[model samples]
Target: MTAETSEPPAFLPGLELSRILYEEGVRPVLDAAHPGLAYAAARVGSGSEVLGFDTARSADHEWGPRLNLFLADADAAALGPAIRELLAERLPKHVRGWPTHFRSDAGNELDPVSGHMTATDGPVDHRVSVDGIGSWLRRQVGSPTAELGPLDWLAVPQQRLLEATAGAVFHDGPGTLTAARARLARYPDEVWRHLLACQWQRISQEEAFVGRCAEVGDDLGSAVVAARLVRDLMRLCLLIDRGYAPYGKWLGTAFARLPVAGRLTPVLRGALAATTYPDRESRLCEAYETVAALQNATGLTEPVDPSCRPYHSRPFRVLHADRFARALAATVTESALRDRPLTGSVDQWVDNTDHLTSSRLEVPE
Candidate 1:
């Protein structure tokens, strides 16, 4: 049997698969076995559903009928393992033709019985993990609680935050998980401005380099700079739209959802694809002006003219992004935030997955 639907036999999206598991496989058992047990159920973390980018191919591993059930700390400790054991015997063998038990690897060998995906009646290490919300948050992000400070916000990876808050919650018994997610929906207004300022600062630092490199006959270097500018510009758009920018895999996908994406997508693509130095420069200048116009429309700061001018003492035409950065910084009322270095958030500067995912990251004071 396959996980086919009336619509088609195509791979089920992670969200749909998760919902089926919750409604058909988990909910009924919980109601019968542990009725009135307060818990939260959701499908989040590292799945395409969390990012809403899953395809049929995503079902190959770590996919299918999986969920997280968050209970009180004590209740979880006492009942979590038993619930897992019960669900292992009770859940349907194939949820929409997808196995509830994932195959596991043991000691350099694929154990069919212990595989991450296996049939029921076997020793099933299920994916329906049970834990307290605090433990869950602590594992997903550093802070177990939601009262995150500026440093905490800066240190937590945007991708992780996005995952933590993105997917659908099937149930929240005490509303704890929902409230925590609300707190992380976005940065505070002041922090948003600070990040925006730093993003602009980044663009300003490098906008001139694109032309400087080209002038030195380093067309390759010029192209590289242009690509970086395009990335920063896309990120800036996300900030302006008050959206969290995911990592590279979904950067473009997330960017496309922004209101400005339709106008800026072609320009950004042209900037990256341009081969000649002059062509690259021209495309980048256009992109910069477009984003500058977007910045002005927000009215977050004193509107600067959305046009390119020649870099001082140089023939290169460029957008003076520092002007925008300074304008945004001026709107920040917090002296402490304004005084901090404009390095932006962790995702802004760090690219390594291991570093971003580490909860022990130290945020600069």
Candidate 2:
């Protein structure tokens, strides 16, 4: 899903109500009839509602009475019919104030059950599987072999990925969700190291280009660089701190709520608003030191002073030039990018990142 079909409803309101239905309306049925079928948990994963960041404006269609049911494949297959029958007969006509806009067929589109239904919504909106940890692990981190390919990491929008990937898991039985969570909970240690290395390289590469952009008589473009610098800085913070950067809409919301938000916010804004290349350079250097301090306090990584100094030279700054070359060659995954070598194009870099984080598509791979 590119930027177009990425609108997800918030999670709490919908999740709370769905949990109620699962425990009271649905769980009892599973306990009585499908006792042999294990009950792991029910959760709401994708959508804005799950992220606790949706506004009232988010309530449109396909935004109410949804729940995900996870069971072993055999259990799901064996008890699928019974569960659906129970949902049809006993599942409340509506949850809280919202109608169970249950669509007739799991495959129904558009007017998809505005209310309630089984987890497996056939082609789209299928309840996720929690039968085992491996399956859930693949879904969470988005391994290519696990139904969805590696999220185009480079192309999918960040906000949508955050919304879909950051929701709550509500309930669980087998702890399959728990194990999978530990893996996808954050980037693996090696992956984080690689990304941090890449990000640092990126800033180094552009350090020399600040003047070039300024020379083009585009203060706006220079400002854009500053903004990008701020973004990367924050992303590094999240990574170093072991948090996934949420979608754009909820970035400030998410960032402000972090423990370091108070400290980092002012620095981030300062970098973004810096007017001159030298000023930006100084601000970023400060940002790096601040990040290093935080990393030390948290024991996230071993401290190492950056070899590159603040940009002070004008023509073909050696450090800046070297860092740029390194950043260009440090890509972790190609899923998000359209072209193999990004060529220092900001638009392409952002575009590819967005694509890589999008939700799994409906059409078969």
Candidate 3:
């Protein structure tokens, strides 16, 4: 293509880019080189696009026409490298005008995943990956398959789980990829109840702190506590809907898509925007009551009163969040999870990037 025709492709969502690359570029190469190969192809994991919140700005780094290609254990071991090299030799300079290559000769092989898509005439250093589905699963969720136990769920991060399950799955020729995504889509009911309880327990641990901090003339600390509660409440709404919450970067974006965001957003914003402790308390209590009522509506357990009252003569209003915590915890019947403390999942207690993003990063019991 001429320089005039070679300007960077206008931004398409990364998932769409993956689709175009597969259909237009990768498929023919695979069909001719290894026909009848049993495999699954998808754009799952890592990128903001996987979670459907990527924008043009996302094109700036680690974004491109790329996807995961899964094969059976035998097929992956025997043919994976061949297929990867074959794509590099035959895939086009661009898939829908976005270069199919993610690395250049000048590129540092040790440079980490910059995801910088660049045009190339030599054998294209394309980003299509070919792997055994089991290996991929182990990297994504610390397992070889999607069947995770309760303790396993607690050890995995929601962000990792979201990445594993949220993105578009484009093909199911091997049949397991679709099933894997479905299995990991949400937690089991008992685990759900346990997590909901822990989330409420998180709020309870802090609801009184908001006012207490302000009373001690630490308005900043009060706001900080209020903000944490707001986040917990948002994540709680995600759990109530049986959806996985993304990490902090996209937490609000994911939360906004939830059914409760319309009612809760205003209250949450009011709490954050409040200038005084009384206003913060008033707005936060409204949020607590709203979410408390939502929990009751789920019928997860016997209804706890959703109204706000003073924090046991401490002059701060609260929903007595532990009541909701206890109520939800009562419904869990899974013996492994039953009577567990309020630690919730790894995401509930751990937010380190290195820890959260690692598949084998086990959390302490």
Model 2: CA > 4 A from native = 1-12, 102-166, 274-285, 296-302, 306-312, 315-354, 359-365
lDDT of each: 0.82, 0.52, 0.86
Q: Stretches of candidate 3 above 4 Å error?
A: 1-7, 104-113
Instruction: Tell me the lDDT of candidate 1.
Output: 0.82
Give the per-residue Cα lDDT of candidate 1 at 253: 92
**Model 3: per-residue lDDT, tens digit, 190-290?**
88999999999998888999989999999999999999999899999999999988878899999999888988899999999999999999999888888
lDDT for model 3 = 0.86
lDDT of 1 at 12: 79
For residues 179-245, could you state the per-residue lDDT of candidate 1 as single tens digits?
Answer: 9899989988888899999999999999999889988899889888888889889989988888788
- Determine the C-alpha RMSD for candidate 3 after optimal superposition of all C-alphas: 2.2
Off by over 4 Å in 1: 1-9, 106-123
Q: TM-score each candidate.
A: 0.93, 0.67, 0.95
Global Cα lDDT for candidate 2: 0.52
